[model samples]
Target: MTDETSARIAPPLTDLPIAVSERGFYSGFSKHVTIPSKIIISLLIVWAIAFPVNAGEVLGIANTTIIRLFSGWYVWLVGGFLVLSIILAALPASGKLRLGRAGDVPEFSRFSWFAMMFGAGLGIGMLTYSTGEPLSHLQNNPVIIAGEATALTENAVRSAYVYSFLHWGFSAWAIYALVGLAIGYVAYRRGLPLTIRSGLAPLLGHRLSGMSGHAVDIVAVVATILGISVTLGLGVEQFVQGLNRIGMGDWLLAKDNSASIPAIVLALMIIVGASTLSALSGVGKGIKWLSNLNLVLSFILFAAFLIAGSALFSLEIFARGLLDYVTALPALSFITNAPDGTTIGDGIAQWQLDWTVFYWAWWIAFAPFVGMFIARVSKGRTVREYILGVVIAPALMCFVWLSLVGGTAVELVLSGAGEGNIVGTVLSDQLYATIAALMDSGLAYAFSVLVVLLLLTYVITSADSAILVVNTINAGGNDSDHGRRHIMFWGVAIALVVGSLLLVGGLDAIRTAMIIGALPFSFVSALLAVAVVKAIWRDTIRLRHGIECTVPPEAKADPAS
Candidate 1:
C-alpha cells in the first residue's frame, strides 16, 4: 500500500514531529474497521443507557456556559481567525496546496465529484434551515432598512433573505476553502495524509512524530465526533418533526423523557446503517450515487415550492433581498457589540455580530471537517479552479436556493395563501410541510417522502464523511480507509454518543456539547493560521533568495483571499 512517489513525508507543518508510527497505527485502524451492520447494533445498545441516567444539572451548567462563553463570542473568534487563515493561503508558498495537476481526469465527471462533496459537506444544513429561518428573520427585521424602523415591511422581507444568504453563502464557505487550500496542499501536493492535526504540520516540522501527534489525533477525533454529532442530532430532530407534520404525528416525540431514549436509538440506527452502507459502497459508487440523488431531490423540492407557491411575490422579495444583502455586507462582515447596550451605537454593531459574526463562527467550527471532505474529493484540479469551486460555486447554489425557497415562504405568508401565521405555529416543523402543502395531491405526498429520503441520504453522507475524517485522524492518515469493522465501530459509536447525548439533553444540550467540543478545534484553527503563515513566510524568503519568481502571485494564480 506504499508508493515511493508519494513517500516524501508531508513537511511537518506544526511545532511537533510527524508521528509516523502513530499515524500508521490509526491508518491501519481505518483500513481494518468497516462493518456497517455491527455499527448499527452497537449504536442501539449505547443509546439505551446514555440517557435517563445522565440528564441533569451538569448538562444545565454546560448549556449556560455555552451561551455565555461560546455562543455569543464564537463568531468573533472563528471569524477573526478565518480571515487570518485566508491571508496565509494567499502567499506563493501556498502553491504547495495545489494537488497533482488536473492529471488525467478521473472516472467521475467534475460536476459529479463536486456534487457529492458539496452535498455531503453542507447540504444537510441547507435543507433543514433554508426556508424556515429566512421567514422567521423577515417577521422580525426592523433594524436594517429604516435603522430601527417599524414592523415588518417590504424591506424587512428583503433583509430576511439577506441574513439567510449571510448564514449560508460566501462568508460561510470561505472557511472551508481556506482550510482545504492549506491542508490539501500539504496532503495532495506534499504527500501528507489528510488529517486536522496536519493543518499545523508546516510549522511543527518533525515534532508531530510521537505522543504529541497522538494527542492531536485523539482531540481531533473527539472534537470532530461531537461537532458532526451536533449536526446529525439536529438532522434527526428535523426529520422526525418533518415526518410528524406530514403524517407521523407527535408519538415520535416520546411519552416520557425516558421513552425518548428509544427514539434516539432508532434514529442512530437509521443514520449509522445508511451511512455504513454508503461507506462500504466505497467513496465513489455509494457516496456519489447518494449525493447525486440528493442534488436532484433538492432541485425538485425547490421547483415544487416555487411553482406551487406565489411566484411573483417571491421574485420581488428575492430581488430586494439581494440589494439589501449587498448594501449591508460590509456591516455584517466582522463588527461586534455586546448585547448589554453598553454604547448607544453599539446596538447597531451587535446586529452585525448576531447575524454575520455568528455565521462566520459557525462556519469556522464547521470548516475543519467540511474543508477536509472538500479537499479529499478536489484532487486533480488547478489551485485557482479548486478555490473558485469550493468557495464561489457553493455560495451561488445557496443564494439561488434561498431566493427561491425563502422568498416563496415569505410570499406565501404575506399574500394570504395557506398560512400567514405559519411562522408562529411551527417554523421548525412545517418548512417541509409547506413544501408539500404547495402541491395538491398524491404527488405532493410522494414528493414529501422523497424529501425525507434525500434528507436521510445527505445525513448519512455527512456522517460517513465525518466517520472517514475521524478515522483519518485516528489512523494518522496511513492512507488506507481502514477495515469495514473498524469504520462501522466508530459509526455506531458516534450514533450512540449523539443519540445518548440527545436523550440526556435534547438538541440544545447537544448544541452546548458541540460548542464545548469546538473550544479545542477553535484553538487548533488559530494554530493552523500561525503555522501556515510561518511556513509561507519562510518559503517566501527562500524563494526570494533563489530564482527571480517568474510570475507574480497575483498574475500566476487567482487568489480567493
Candidate 2:
C-alpha cells in the first residue's frame, strides 16, 4: 500500500498518437481516434441528418420500430443487474475498496463532489420529470387502472410516488455507479486508460488493444452523444415551456407557439456555447462553479415551492412516499406486471414497456458519460462512500423534489384548486405549467426565473462533462488532451444531434434514438459489472499477498507483455 505499489497498480500508459496533420474544422480526425469510433460517428451524423430530412419514412417507422423491439426485457435486466452491482459493492468485503490508491484523498471537497455528481448524474431529468412523471403515474398507473379506480385515491397516490422513485432512484444511479467504479479502479488503481475499453481489461486483458477495445470505445461515444442529446432536447423543450409560462414566448418565438425551429436553435446555441467554454475551462473551474450555482438555484426553487405551496401537505407526502417507496422496493423492483386476477387491459407488460423499460434504456444510455464524470471526480473514495454519494443521496433528494413539486400538483388538481387539467398540462408543459398552477403570481415568476437559471446550469454541466468524456474516450482515455478545438467539436456535435432530432420527431424521436442507442451498451454494462467484481477479487488477493502479489497468469499480464 505504499506510494510505489500504488503507482505500480496503475497500468502503463499507452502512447496512442494523434495525427496532428489531419486537422480540419473542429480538431479534425486524430490517429488516436479508432476506426470503429470514427465510422460509427460518421454514420450517426448521416443518420441524424436523414432522420430530419426524411422524417416520414426514416424516423417515423424505423427508429420507432427499433425502440419498440429492443426496449423490453433487455433494458429491464440492465436495470436489475446495475442495482445488484451497487448493492454488492456496498457490502463489507468489497465496500472498503478504494477507487484509487489506498488512503488517497479525494481531489474535490465533499460539497463539490456531491454537487458535481448530482448535477451530472441527473441533469435536466429532474427539471423535466419532477412534476410530470409523478402526476402521470397517479393518473395512468397500471395498478390503479387494473383496479378500476377512476379517481386519485390514497392508494393511487402511494403507487404514483413509488413508480416515480423507481425510475429515478437506486436503479438509475446504479448504472452510473457500476461504470464509474470499473473505470475509476482501472484508471486509478490498475493504471489503465480511463476509457470504456479499460473497464474491461480484467475481463479482456490484451484484447483491450485489439478491435474489441476499439468497439467498446465506439459504443461509449455513440451512446454518450445520443444519451446526452436526448437530455439536451428535453431540457430545451422544458426551457421553452418556462419561457412561454413566463410570458416571454413571444419574444423568443412567434405568437402562441412552442417548440418552434427558431426557439430550438436559440436554446441550443446558448447551451452549446456555454458548455464549450465550460469544457475548455476544465473540470475544476467551470464545471465546479456551475455545479455549485446549480445546487444553490435548486435549493432556492425547492424552498420557494415548499413555502408558497402547502408545506404540510408536501412534507406529509414526501415522508409517507419515501417509506412507501422503501416498503415497495422488493416487489416494485421485480414488478413487471399485474397478477392473474386483474384481467385488466394490458396489465404489466405494456406498463413495463412504456415507463420502466424506457427509463432503464435512458439510464443505460447515460451510464458512460455520467459514470466517467463520476469516476473522474471520485478518486480517493471508498466504494461505500461512492455508492452513498452517487446512488442513495441523489435518489432521496429526487423523491423529496418529486413529492413537493408533483405531489402539490396532484393535490391541487384533486382539490379543484387549479384551473387547467394538471395531468394534461404536465404532459405538454411539464414542470413549468405545474409550477405556474401551484404558486401565486409572485412566486410563479420567481420559480420561472429559477427554472431558466437551473436549466441553463444543469445542461451546461451535462454538456461540458459529456464533451470531456467523449474526448477522453476518443483520445484512448488520455484526459490531458484538453485541446479547445476538440471540446468545441463535441459541444457542437451534441447541439446538432439534439437540434435536428428536435425539429424532426420532437421529443419522441429523440427518445426513440436514445433507446436504440442504449440497446447495445446495455450488454456493455453487464460486462462491466462482471469486470468490476473480477478486478475487486484480484485486488483483494494482491492486498493479502503483498510484494509477491498473486493473480492468474492472464490477470498478471503487463501492458508490454
Candidate 3:
C-alpha cells in the first residue's frame, strides 16, 4: 500500500469521554471514580480505628487466604510480565514506536526523569530493604532451608544475595515498566485518558467508558493507597527508630522497641502534611526537587558505606552476587513451591509467602501509583528506551545499593564487627545499628541524622507523587492541577490508612492489608500484559503495511474534549 492509502486507512485517535464534576465539592473530579474510591478507603480507615484488634485479625486472615490461593498466580503473572516487557522492547517494530507524536520532545531531562522514576518507584524500598533483606536472607532462605547452604556462614552469602537481588531486581521493575508502557502508549499515542483502564483499551475498546472502567480504576486507587501505606508504615517505624537512636528518648518506642501510637501519629502528621504541601506544588517543581535531593543523599550514604564499612568485601559481593542473581534469575522468576504435606514443602511454601510472594504483591500493589507517575513523566520516549530506562537502569542501581549497603551489613556479621547487634535488631533498626557499629558515637549519630533526612525525603516524595497519581486517576487522567483541597484530602486519607493500620498491628497489619488489596489489581495487571501485547502486535502489522503506528499530531484528540 502507498503512504497516502495507508494514511487514509489509519485509525483515528478519538478521545474517550469521562465524566467530571463541573460544580460541587468534587468539581473538576470524576465523581464516578473519586466517590467510590474515597468511600472504600474511608470505610477501611474507620474499621481499623474503631476495632483495631478485629481489623488486624480480619486482615491477617484475608491475607493468608489470598496468598494461599494465589501464590502461584502471582509468581507466574509477575514472571510473565517480565517476559512480555522484554519481548515488546526487543521487537524491532514495537521498540521504535514513540509514546507521543513524531514532533513531540521529552519534557524532562534524562537525569531528572531517572531521578523521579527511581524515587517514586523504589527509593523508599531501597532504604528499607537494602540492609534488612540481605541480612534476613542470610539467616534463612529456601536454599538455606533446603540444606544447599548453611545460614550465617560464608557459603550462604551468595544465596542471601541471590534472593535479595531476586526481590529487588529486574522482575520487580518489570511490573512497573509494563504498567507504565501500556498506559503511556494508549494515552499518548491513541489519545485515551491516562488511567488504568486506558491500558486495556486494545482489549476492552468502548467498554472502558462505563462501569467496568470505573471498577478498574477503583482497584488501582485502592491498591495505590494500600501500597504506599505499607511504605509509609515501614518508613514511620524507621523514622521513629532513627529518632530514638539520635537521643529522642525512650518514649518514642514501646518496650518491644516498636514505635508507640503517639510516635506513629506524630510521624504521620509530619510526613503527610509535608507531602500534601509538596503535592500542591505539582510534579515538575516539588517532586522533581525532592527526587534529585534524595538521589544525592543516597549517593552520600552509599559512599559512606564504601569508605568506612568493608569496601573490598562489598565490591566482591557486588560482583559475585550480581552474577549469581543473573544466572539464577530465570529459575527464580518462575519458581513456585507448593505444599506437598512434607515438612520441607511446607517450610518452603511459608518462606515463599513471606518473602517472594509478599514482595510481588507489594510491587504489584505499588505499580499503579509508580506506573502512572512514570507514564506521566515519560512521554516522547520509544518502547526500547522506556523499558531500558525503567527496568534495566533502576535494577542495576538497586543491585549496586544491595552490594554496597547490604553487603556491608553482611560483612559486619561475618567479621564480628557488629558483634550480633545488627542481626539481633529489628529490620528498621538494622541500618542504624550498622552505622553505629561502623563509626564512633559522634560520627554515627551524625550519619544517622543524614540517613533520617534521606528517609524523610523518600517518604515525602513517594507520598506526594502518589497523591498526584490518585488525583490524576480520579479526574479521569486529567493531568492539570487539581485544587489544593483534593491533594490534602488524599494526603490525610493516606495518613489515616497508614496510621490506623499501624496502630492496629504495626507494620504487619499494614502489610496484610496491602497484600489483600493487591490481589484484585494483580488480575487487572495480568489483563494489562495481554492488552499491551495485543496493541503492539496490531501496531507492528500497521508498520509492515507502511502505515504510521503513532497518531499524527493533527489527528490526536484532546482528553479534555
Q: What is the per-residue lDDT of model 3 for residues 159-267, given as tens digits with 9 covering 90 to 100? A: 9998998998899999999999889988888778889988988888777889999999999999999999999998899999999999998899998999988998999
Task: Report the C-alpha lDDT of model 2 over 1-561, residue by residue, as the tens digit.
Answer: 687665545433222222322455424333445445546655666676765566535655765565557654655665576567666666787788777765478999999998999898785888888878877887778677667555465567877887898888887788888888888877776566678878887777777776677778778888988899888988887787777777874655444345778888888998899999999988999999999999999998888778777678778888887888788877666655533555465565567777887888889899999999999999889888887888888888888888888877878777777665566553537676667777778877878888888998999999999999888887777777586777877787788788877766678878877877888888898889888887776666556546322222124445421
- Report RMSD for candidate 2: 4.6
- Cα lDDT listed for each candidate: 0.62, 0.76, 0.90
Q: Which portions of model 2 miss their true places by more than 4 Å?
A: 1-39, 48-56, 60-72, 151-154, 251-257, 338-347, 426-428, 547-561
Query: What tens digits encode model 1's per-residue C-alpha lDDT throughout 421-534?
Result: 456455445566566546675876777687778778889888887777665665566536545766777787777767767766676656656555566666666666566555
Query: In lDDT terms, how accurate is model 1?
Result: 0.62
Of 1 and 3, the candidate ranking higher by lDDT:
3
- Using TM-score as the measure, which candidate wins? 3
| TM-score, ranked from best to worst | 3, 2, 1
By descending lDDT, how would the candidates be arranged? 3, 2, 1
Stretches > 4 Å off in candidate 1: 1-27, 30-56, 70-73, 77-97, 101-108, 141-153, 245-250, 254-263, 341-361, 534-561
Ranked by TM-score, the better of candidates 1 and 2 is: 2
Give stretches of model 3 more than 4 Å off.
Answer: 1-13, 552-561
